[model samples]
Target: MNSKVINEIKIKDGRVLTLVEGDITERNVDVIVNPANSYLQHGGGVASTIVRKEGNIIQEESDKIGFVQVGSSTITSSGILPCKSIIHTVGPRMGEGNENEKLSKAINSCLGLCLRKGFESISIPAISSGIFGFPNDKCAKILVNETISFLKNLEDSSAGIKLVEFCILGKDTLQAFQYEFEKSKPEF
Candidate 1:
């Protein structure tokens, strides 16, 4: 729960892009995206932290969904966390095929799933930038770009998402996302 706001961008549709230096497990958004393995295993990095805080039930439900393809995602009810649900997404490893494209697809898929579930707000970490070894700056650029693109495509406020947060961990990741957000935000 030690998260503090680092930065924020208000999109044209009234939605927000937030950058926070904190633990996603403590975020109170409607959903929190977990960067998980295709097997839905919560064994390391942010995934492990989430499982440690939320308990085994998150993994139990994920196990039912079994395996998810890289760049794809699925959802499960939050076990003990404050959020209502968790969206587990499989992110690509560093040397995986077309790492950048796979990472972008993974984030877009997570956001798409959240919208379909009617979630108005979600907190996401820097997927694949941790144990998956994707570079923080590259991760920042792709994630922030895809997020802005997704929000800009919303036809109206009723698209169901009003907030998308990059609940990043580590000072380096936080800075990376912050820089990307600043660089991409519209000149107003």
Candidate 2:
């Protein structure tokens, strides 16, 4: 559960974007996004880890909500986790048509949901980059770029999202995100 910050950048609006190497389930942010399947099943991967650590109430809530569409997101109470809420976002699987666009939409959906709920901080993983077969570097680029775009477009300086973190567990995934973070630093 120990997590460490790998990189961080501050945007003009005073918001912070960070790359962390650790378990997203341990993040104490306002919300932590779960890369989910449409059926809301927490069977394997990060979804399973979150449910195992945070308790089954997360799964129970997801069951009540039923299916969520790809490129969309839904929220549930955080259960025993420190975060206030969990945003389950369905990302596209590789070989799916327009995978890049779908991934972008998924990221945007999570960010938009966070804005609506007034969440000041959120932790997200590299959606679809695991068993779903998304390439790590591409996933990293899309996730980082989409998040920066979302924050920059917000008209209100007090939009409540002061922090956006990419919390990755694997070393390769963390490296990919770190590369993106470095590439995007100057632009921010």
Candidate 3:
């Protein structure tokens, strides 16, 4: 329930990248990214948490959407949450081939959805790092780097995205993201 901004950096074109210690479901932003399975099941992990807090409308909408491919995403109403919408993205499992590329694609998909929807702010968790078994450090690094690249490459058409926050839960995950942000600070 308690959430706080741990660190942040300004990237090219005045985009803000932030690391937050909190529940992604509680983020007060335009949209929140859900690390979902291909089937859009809200059965466990962060998916279940979002359902429990936001209500079953999210699951109902996901059920209507049917299946989303790994490294892709879909959007749904946010139910009772503060945000307006949710971007449910499927991330690859750890043992799957090309895990790194898959995770990167997942992040890109979320960001792309944000751009298309004209959402200026979003909160994302460490995709595939929970029940899917991705390494915390690797997830942190990929998420940080990919987000930075996306923000930096934004042109006039994609400039609506002003804020991106990694709303991490566990201490270790938060620390990993913090480390990545700190390491990337000088480059931006």
Q: Quantify all predictions' global Cα lDDT against the true fold.
A: 0.91, 0.93, 0.93
TM-score of candidate 2 relative to the true fold: 0.97
1-188 per-residue lDDT for model 3 (tens digits): 79999999898777899999998888899999999999998999999999999888999999999999999999999999999999999999999899999999999999999999999999999999989999999999999999998988898844589999999999888889999999998563
Ranked by lDDT, top first: 3, 2, 1
Q: List the candidates' TM-scores in order.
A: 0.97, 0.97, 0.97
Query: If candidate 3 were superposed on the true structure by all CA atoms, what would the RMSD be?
Result: 1.2
lDDT of 2: 0.93
lDDT of 2 by residue, 64-98 (tens): 99999899999999999989999999999999889
Displacement of residue 133 (Cα, Å) in model 2 is: 0.9
Pairs in clash, predicted candidate 2: none
Which residue pairs collide in model 1, if any? none
Supply candidate 3's per-residue lDDT for 174. 86
Model 3: runs farther than 4 Å from truth? none
Q: What lDDT tens digits, residue by residue, belong to model 1 across residues 63-82?
A: 88998999999999999899
